[model samples]
Target chain A: MISRMRILDGTLLALEAEGMRPTAARAAGWRRAVAGCGIDSLETLLPPAGAGDSPDRASPVAESSSPPGNAASRRSAAPERPPSLSELIARVLPTTVVPSVSALANLASGAFPQSGWHCIYGLGDALFADRKTLARSIDSLSEGREALLAPCFTNERGCATALAVEWLLGGEDRAALVSFAGCGGLAALEEVLAALLVHGGLPAADLRGLPELTDRYRRMGGGPIPPAKAVIGEAIFSVESGIHVDGLWKSPDLYELFPPEIVGRERRIIMGKHSGKRAVLVKCGALGLPVTADLAERVLQKVKEESARRKTSLCDTDFIALYSTCRAGKDEKEEGGRAVL
Target chain B: MRFCKIVDTTLRDGEQAPGHAFSLDDKVFLASLLDGAGVYQIEAGVPAMGRDEQDAVCAVKDACKTAVVSTWNRLTEEDVRASVACHPDIIHLCLPVSERHITRKLRTTQAALLRQFSRVAEYAAGRGYRVTAGFEDASRAEVPFLLQAAETAKRHGIERIRLSDTLGMLRPSSAALLVRTAREVGLPVEMHAHNDLGMALANSAIAVLAGAGFIDTTLLGIGERAGNCGLGAFVAACREYTAISPLQARKAERLALPLLSRCRQRKFFT
Candidate 1:
């Protein structure tokens, strides 16, 4: 079995790092949406002080003359357990995927509260146990109705991929915990999501809003996304090679498996050292300066040499400058021909 | 399990990091260090970049005593000429097997790429040079073409097949399948993985488990974009399978940390 489907949003804790605070009303709505989407828990790093945790939200006790607020305060003062996000999420949802960065017995027990969590999320080899011992415990945990053993991962070697290997060995009942870009942050979330969709483990349409989530993190002071970060990189779809351009013009799928539109990106072809003459011809056509076949070769040679010297792709401005030079030479030749006539 | 050979490419692909160039001394230092760590091969550098690069590749071949020296080349005669200039132990020839690399990168079709590799492999092999044919992005290549490319190389006397996850898109399951399939063609397989999807170390490890005969790595996994598998980390993760004593792995970690930090100016996790 694929285990009961649930996507616990772990972004709340990462949001705290960016100094963004969720208002009480927003928190209540967010929690409601998460629950509605079948996510069993809100995996926040810090205890959520959201409206979902407000005393007014929980059902009130009977036989109390005091106002609902006073009775709620009285009950809060004599709590049976310390405040925990896992408990908070469990109260509203059917299942929780608790965050356990460590393997402390106290933390594990608290994170995986009885009759609440659907699974435990942590780095693969949660306590550095060998594969055999780990598999045994995972099997034991999964015995209950819809209890999943999810191994969390970052970009660290043997991260999610290693967990996947173990999961395949252990069977599909196991789950995987991963951030969008393979880290706790939102950057590269969409790209990583795309990879997962392509990797054949999850339904592509089931995933939503990786780019939007990443944007939210950036707005919260997480900083701009790394331009070359694997999947979501700015340059991932951009190509400059003549052959790439030729194939891309024929079919984008020829080079990249998924459409850039999958992640809200577009294809681009810039002129560079590895560029072919077709690229030059295309650029010239775009500029409305149709080049003769001979001129195309000369322009392409110049572009390649200059890109090599610069050790980078030529910017549009550089291409324009080259066009201007060629255009001026052509104009002068035409004038000389007129004078000869 | 086959005893996997370790080929460190820190000086080659690692140096290809955008806007980064390593001096001769840095190349010599890394080559010697990897050699001391018992790496079976060191892909020193790309001699085809220029004469200076060729000279540096030559210098690396001379600097290391234990590890066999090699240079990376594309499936072209000019590049083979450059590798010839270096006079190294193995001429590592590369051909793009995926439709993307063949059509876009080389502007050639699969048939053309196969034809080119046959001629290039023959040229290098007939010269009495030890040749290793790398199917760049073999993970994305059509299965039939990949097998055909391997068979052609095998026919041309290529000694090894380097199956690279060029885009780093390979998963452990697919990696095992690809490596196993390539082995059937009768050539030893090497796993050259990228960390594009953050799966390099894991993919390499799984490939080793699946019977690939060599694992490609770079120190700190520093290369283009995310980088290749880190030598120290790969050694640490597969220490038992690779047969290095824990003490030796620890020593390698110690030597790699300082140089890696100096190279990239960050506290790299690997």
Candidate 2:
């Protein structure tokens, strides 16, 4: 049978109850015994001397806190020591209950091994209902440059709300990263977490609010950006039924969590079935087309009709030629290069 | 400085080159050849490319003994999952880090792209598989973006970050600078040079000198477009630059030439 060790039932219990370590408790008792009225000698604190000692010898005061030639000290120091478990739990519990979950996280990672103490912090299981406790936990966790891993529960509700709030407060990088098990219920949230996990963790510097933060997270998550997955959605970026390719090229801060350089690719406006002159003019002008809007529109109409007949997207060369003719200021009625209008 | 891993992507990217095809026998033969050549890694192919590619990757998986076999993927979870079926020691996912490409092709922001890449990287890492992130077309990517990608990959627990000159646009000096930058960004760098400018070998040399531990190459420099730098040239160059005894370098140099000849005979000439 496996033996259970209890640290609370021994003489060490009173000391432990006062939040003192076993070694400290022993030293305190030894000091008291040494100074006491009746028990002036350290021997009073120690077990009785046995055959191992000379009969006429006076026991050393220094040896009193230490176990003598008896079974007591061995049992006390053994892994199965009675009060160890409870003492350990007590020590850990208080630290774990610290409002700063972030610090607790650092302790777990052994990041601050020199701290000489592993803090006891809350698991956030029951404390989620308490905002003050939750806030405290977040503060504790975010205190140092330590990383935090959010422990996921059944509903996955606690971390999601906490993280969302943290992001809004510009605490995205400092917030605990939700565990991967939480990915399915909150796809978007998990996407953010997944991205963070993938890229290792967000750089503490570039972290920001929801749209930008989530956008950054989604890229690292490596889940296929669905056609409609918020900022990364194919549709969110592409212009629909319009000519402008849209948006500034650099300074992702304005665009929300991105510049195009994240991928070795660029945007190209492709004229298609729904092409119009204004759309053509806008695309060409944005990309530096020299053509008039009216002429560009006429050519775009013809190109659209041709693409519809052929059931294919307009090729780059075709679009280029059409744009070139319009920009060349050709007459609308000219035979070879006339604008379709 | 303590450990250097030279990964050969001959089988994977080489196959992607036009006019290059390898049968099963060819794969086993090449893998055995690579093993004897002391390559630390061999990227077989993207497993999900097709049944044949997957089978080839599996065959490589079974054949390679001394080298860690790996496969390629996009920075996506599905790609990683599919690539795992081949049982490689590593899965290499490519992400584009240049602003032009990110804006024009992906139409997404770098911040977002990085997030996606990180998620997939961690997922792959969590599965107990070594993961390497390839910054495709890294030669043209802005310095800040490239450094960020490298740093990000390091944080995500990737085994290495490969800076690929997808268009083979970098010179040796530039390649060296990038490799050094990658090291400064705190990443184990790998160089994937193409011969688009006929300087693939030169660039590969620069990468190594700049602290790149891995260099992607093909047998006899066989890859896309102008092909990659000749592997033979690289081994020979290392023999010259490394701080080893001249006698040892001479022997290595001599051995590499014959090995190069044999590889060409079997892989191309034959």
Candidate 3:
């Protein structure tokens, strides 16, 4: 459950590519377009590798480049290239800001639409390498620096924290770039919200928009994002493993930061390789399946085997099949269904 | 600052994602692309899966013109025989090093495990295929013992040892330290990390900095559970931070990544 005030989302570009629908304006009218997601001209975002391109994009994506000394690649003279960002952005709204200094420079030079576009200067540790020059570039950008203020975060790696503090104290209008998860940005976002709630002279009323803010984020990430992703993965509420499952079963608050209902997700007892009998019993009980102790243990072993065989946690179909197999002497067959509660 | 070689196990580890198995054609296509991208080595797939699997591995080996083709296996002659039949350049023989895995997973003593592995590595060496021993769950193994195991495997003709953070439990600092410690065994250490904590990238970077000669990665980091370090992410970071060869970065940039729809499909967990 998200117990923070509000976090500016950086998922628009990612979500747009996934074809997720645009959400309504938030209560605060803040745009859901990620700060670094919007592009001026997708083609010109990165200079082409050859003439108007970055050196990396010099090769055409269709013509695969074979490594040197290989007869096939020796014939072609170039390796297969990765899809350009433009090609990738074709399906989605090209709203993500170009975090690279080079791409950001291109963005600053290009003419962007007046409305629905907010320029965020993406800065991570790379800024530290040339802080003075990067700072000068930002200071020099005359028109849209006000719109710019996207800081690339890499965990609590000090730089992101320092930049956030500077923004808060220096009165910069920039929003802290919060990745829904990974690179350490998720926890940082919570910290930022906590600080703002306490220090920034903002009232709790201002913080009420976080849930809506979170919904906007969900919209950008598309439907049913991975359950285990750090901040955004739904797997947070779905407990697996014996120790944590037992603890959570004993006291809901013992393991989780908040209730799963807060995030519109439910606490699932997933029977996995490391799952204890409690997880199996809970999941079975929820599905209204009655089983003796031995049956539960048998079902659990089957689940672990299937999970290990498939190299993932068993889904609902797997659970049902296992339960049915345990109940009767019949063999289990793969079925396409899930254990959704 | 030394350059690191990449062995992409997308086909093998990536395919391990629950309900995600690529058709042979997809495997061949991905192989061609990865090879063309100058990926140093391609751990195509574990041929031990079966005949069709063997044929798939052979097809990838035949299709590639440059990338070194390899296959994974357990510490057993039957799996090794399957690996040999596929005709890969390297046979990756995996053995558990951690006490938990040795006791709970493999249910064997360390001495018995080592002895059995030596036989497998020796058999693989005699078969004219280069052998790389994977120390499964090595991070949990005692440092000195792990190095000793590597040295013993080295003596048995295993050319390399892959240090797997099998459970994805190592911190970046510990990952680096493990690589540094494994360096004493005098064989190239390949870092095979999992992403349980989303720190696979950080751990991979630290391994590169700490002198792991090779990094085991998958395209899009598609592997078990949280997945492996993404090939694109690892290459991109390397390009930005280190003096890595531009060949890799260029290929990574231009490679038509599988669409998010495919990646996001619950089946494939990249």
Best by lDDT: 1
Chain B of candidate 2 vs. true chain B, TM? 0.86
- Each candidate's interface RMSD (Å, one decimal) is 7.1, 21.8, 8.7
Q: Residue pairs in steric clash, candidate 1?
A: A243-B104, A244-B104
User: How many backbone overlaps does candidate 2 show?
Assistant: 61
DockQ of each: 0.22, 0.01, 0.04
Say which prediction, candidate 1 or candidate 2, comes out ahead on lDDT.
1
lDDT at A223, model 1: 53
The models' CA-based lDDT, in order, is: 0.61, 0.50, 0.58
Q: Tens-digit lDDT track for model 1 on A1-341?
A: 43342233444434432344344344444434333322332222222333133444322222212111121122335344443333332332323342333342233323432342343433443322344655454444444444333443433334454454345334543344334344442222343344555765444343334345555455444555554455555544555645457656666655465676765556666765556777777778877776887777777767666765654556677877776666566656878633211
What is the lDDT for B187 in model 1? Answer: 90
Candidate 3 local lDDT, B1-270, one digit each (tens): 466888888788766554444556767888887887778789988776667678889999999998899998978999999999988999999887877667665677888988898888889999999999898878789876797799888798888889998766555556878999999878988999876545576677778778888988887676655567777777766664433354664465346355212433442122
Candidate 3 per-residue lDDT, tens place, A205-273, comes to 133333454555554453544534422353334545554466567655433444545334456666555
How much is B11 displaced in model 2, in angstroms?
0.8
**Tens digits of per-residue lDDT for model 1, B104-222:** 66778888778888899889987889999988878898899899999999899999999988767776767878999899998999999876665677778878877888999887676
- Cα deviation at B186, candidate 3, in Å, is 1.4
Clashes of each: 2, 61, 35
Ranking by DockQ: 1, 3, 2
